[model samples]
Target: MSGNDILVTDGLSKRFGDFSAVSDVSLRIQRGTIHALIGPNGAGKTTCFNMLTKFIAPSSGRITFNDRDITAMRPADVARLGLVRSFQISAVFPHLTALENVRIALQRKRGDSFDFWRSKSALEPLNLRALELLDSVGLTSFAYSKAGEISYGRKRALEFATTLAVEPEMMLLDEPMAGMGHEDIDRIAELIRHVSANRTILMVEHNLQVVANLSHRITVLTRGRVLAEGDYRTVSENDEVREAYMGAGHA
Candidate 1:
């Protein structure tokens, strides 16, 4: 692995009985770069994210984060080590106000999430951090709005803010732009670029244009294996990628 690599996988594989979901997938993500994974549906991209984040155990292989072996670590442990993931679906609390949701996440990061007896004013620092997160994601104007009342795009943005409360070193984003309108997509693309400036971002996305625009490097997967790995031009021009897309009727 390169000295600057923040995340690495060697011979990673996952199987459900006789069916292999991911096979011998080795990948390296450099620090402070946006690395994108692109493929057709059911290409095992989500499975790979689950294994890397320790949400699911790999059938075989190894994972390293910050140069430490973490293949078998629990999800919380992995998260605590500064590797955080944002789900494709929003994980925000719909009933809570946007500010409250972020405040809760910040409290969790501070290990005070279970301190329910304390009044809101007592946790001044946590509340301040939560506001900072909301401002960072451009949601401060909606701080008092119920999370469920926000636009779908803004809710997704709120999710990103919650993830930032943990101050991760690296992020695994699953379809960050999913279901967004054109304007929202542009906004999110900008937000992603802003966030990626300080940390490594590894994302799985179906939008080729977004991937081409944002990713410094691209890894194309097919049939649970890597078909190509390189820059936008290289992957776009690759024969294997062309074949994969053509077979999926997306070409």
Candidate 2:
């Protein structure tokens, strides 16, 4: 792998019993770039994510991050190495205030996450950082509101803020635009652009327009393997991608 690569996978494969979910997939994501993974439903995109994030062990393959082998690392260990994944489903704590959720994530990053006896004020630095992250994601106005009280789109933004508090070097975002209205989608896209300026982002998205607008490169998967990889225009115009999308009625 080259020095500029932040995430690399070689011959990555995953299986469940007799079923192969992802097969012989090799990917390289450059540092400080936004890369999109696009595929039809049941095409193993989420399975690939599970393998990458260590949520599930890959049946076979090698994964390297920053030139270090990480194929067998635990999820938490991978996270501590500045690799973080935001789930497709919302993950914010509904009962907690947005600021509190971000503060909790900040505390986790500071290694004091389990120190329950410490007063909230004792971690004033974490609170400050959390506020800064919330501001960055445009959630400062709703900082004190319960996460559940925020609009669905704003809740997603809060989740992004929480992820930012972890200070990840590479971020894995699963459908950040899922369930969003046009205005919310525009706002989130801008936030993603701002975040991608400093950190590498690998996103799994179904919205081709958003993918085209945000990604520096696009990787298209079909049935368990890469069918095409290139810029939006290149992939969209590729025969294999066109066929895959047409077969799935999503072209």
Cα error of candidate 2 at position 100, Å = 0.6
lDDT of each: 0.88, 0.89
Model 2 regions more than 4 Å off: 246-251
Name the top lDDT candidate.
2
Clashes of each: 0, 0
User: RMSD (Cα, Å) of candidate 1?
Assistant: 1.7
Q: How accurate is candidate 1 locally (lDDT)?
A: 0.88
Pairs of residues at least 3 apart in sequence or in different chains that clash in candidate 2: none
| TM-score per model over all chains | 0.94, 0.95
